[model samples]
Target: MRRTTNRSAHRAGRAGRVRRTATASGAALALALTAAACGDGDTTGPASEGEFSGQTVTVAGVWTGTEQENFQKVLDAFSEKTGAKTDFLSTGDNVSTVIGSKIQGGDAPEVVMVPQVGVLNQFADNGWLTPLSSDVEQDASQNFANVWKDYGTVDGEYYGLYFKAAHKSLVWYSPDAFAQAGVEAPDSYAAMMETAGTISDSGLPAFSVAGQDGWTLTDWFENVYLSQAGPEKYDELAEHNLPWTDRSVVDALTTLGELFAEDDLLADGAAGALRTDFPTSVQKVFGPEPQAGMVYEGDFVGALVTNDFGRTLGEDADFFPFPAVDGGEAPVVSGGDAAVVLKDGKNQEAAMALMKFLASPEAAAVWAEAGGYLSPNKELDLSSYGDDLTRQTAESLVEAGDTVRFDMSDQAPAAFGGTAGKGEWKILQDFLRDPSDPEATAAELEKAAAAAFKG
Candidate 1:
């Protein structure tokens, strides 16, 4: 349970939002919350006494498989506390398109788990999201950092409450590979490249490139750009206030080229990489045969390596921070799914209740105890996390405070940041294939960004 005192005024404002009224039931809920705090048997608080007994709250999101199952547990906890039936609708990859169609067809879900900040902004701007009530805001303020609030806010009203978070600046590698190569986890960009070269020189490909997934390329560019140009410049580029052709962009690309330019450093060369999707890329490094020595991605890769490949984190597989660049500190780039209420939903009251519950440490603990999940809730006990690596990762993000940033691509419009074979994604993949001309790549990026940001 890390804490920060920098946002005192913001926290004060949040504290002023709403105060709990004392009723017999409210007092009982408070007692239950206190007992839950003491690590008692009932961790999720007491079941509601027929509050919203017949209501069904539908939640739309992109989660499926294990992720869907884990999130359902959180919803179940909410249901138990509020006495409402909860239904989850998986919208697959095209969340915005599916949700938009549903809204237009008068069939919007009561809540939506939005994955991108840009998409959340679009929804909020279009008046499709309901403004969260004061009680919900106060709960969010108490349990989450101000940055989470900032992400969910639109024109001074909070809407989205982030439930699941991803720390995206990790580089996973095998300790055995590093030992065989006679190298160590790096502290700087140059050292990481040297490590890659050493690992490759030892008869294994040093890195696995997920070139087919254009979003991964965007992430590569973001980590470099953030470390090189710093936060203000990062914000400028993400918002398109600064052109992509700016020298900062070119510099970042050039720094990234230190790795991308070396064909020997990447597994199966650029052609093979271009055909590889994200899961295959991970498999190349941690799979049964182990084609490569390392892979870079978010903490989610831990789950894949542990579950699919039968590797143990901190043993067979582990991660290091994305190394520092140009004498600057490494930046923490993060992504998350925000929970927002639908403006036209019939279960507004129950939806708001769920939102409040989603903001609590108790709800966060549910997912944290389940593997492969991270929470932005500041008050969540680190012990709630199932393992040390997971707990440390969550602690790092929560303690990063003002220094932490959302994924740069996720902050941009989907056309530029998310779509495959288009905009930043395509431009970066092109850059990945041909690192000889970063200037031209920057120009292409500027062109795509200019067009996308105009919308």
Candidate 2:
């Protein structure tokens, strides 16, 4: 449910893609609120006084192209306003490796942008993150209270600040195409399926599901699970208390497999999904001759489509919340990037000051304008968004009183997340190619989940 825009799809092209060669065994941490011990209480070698006064803070993350351009504008503005010199170390990929190397070398950035929530906890556990409760206290409600008080906290301390959050569980479609096919916005999963089938019958593909990165499929499963099981079970599963073979998990995967089985539902046999790259697969969705009726992606997909197809969200695209399923409560799946102060940094006060500033409504507004990311600060007026689609998305956040955090795949233990993507996606792909043995596939996934959780 993280904001996996089309930009994430381009991660494969990151210049310094750090491929994790070592595979470990453990229950992948889920994006859930669980109590755990804090780090070793290591201060980054006694916070230096006025260390940041004349020093240029180096920021690192895997953002480039237009995304970088947008981020730089914000950084430039921050420097102009605060007179805090800043240097952005933009990298194409290998974000973890780059950050890890910096930390190991005792030269990590003052503030690091971590996209995956699961890794944040791991970093904190390793004494690699500095607590930020003081910053949080400066401005409380402006931050997404739950996310800050829960996921960003460990052992009663805050170590991260939410800058921007993305709404997932969004189904984007060509309004023109939907109208041409005589469809209405679906209010339920059943209605959505019926509409999809009808759209396909009208000679258009139903959905564009990119399974190459396997994370997209994870989003589908998480959304369905959230709708079917509600927040409690979702949180339990994320915390590793529930097994993947549970009825709810199986039910969600089964639902996705059924969608995949539908004729003309996904582009060219969804099994081909395993081979298509993330960017290419997304391009197919927003192509000139759009192949699918709808695409389930995060807010970032709009950027990807715009960058690749020169299509704007409102002109060529619009989105609907993924329809409610199993008569469950309605909630949106939201994800965003958080700035974690590394425990190894020498400028804790300066870094924390920057974080506090970032949490301010003013800074959030600037981020919205610069990066197209929804500000976590509720006090920030979104009236200036201008674009109808963006405004609608922002409104959805206000309306979503209970947001399911990012998908467990990204928030859970890395092993489980990876297995869920690689293992679960393969199972889904097989079922799509031929809906011959859903039970067997379900059993296999259940076993895989057990193995992952057992570790």
Report the number of the highest-TM-score candidate.
Answer: 1
Clashes of 2: 13
| TM-score: model 1 vs. ground truth | 0.90
Candidate 2 global TM-score: 0.83
For model 1, what is the error of residue 371's alpha carbon versus the real structure, in angstroms, after optimal superposition? Answer: 1.4
Residues 33-54 of candidate 2 have per-residue lDDT tens digits of 1000111111121113332445
Can you give the TM-score per candidate against the true fold?
Answer: 0.90, 0.83
Instruction: Judging by lDDT against the true structure, name the best candidate.
Output: 1
C-alpha lDDT values of all predictions: 0.79, 0.63
The local lDDT score (0 to 100) that residue 40 gets in candidate 2 is 16
Model 1 segments more than 4 A misplaced: 1-48
Q: For model 1, how many clashes? A: 0
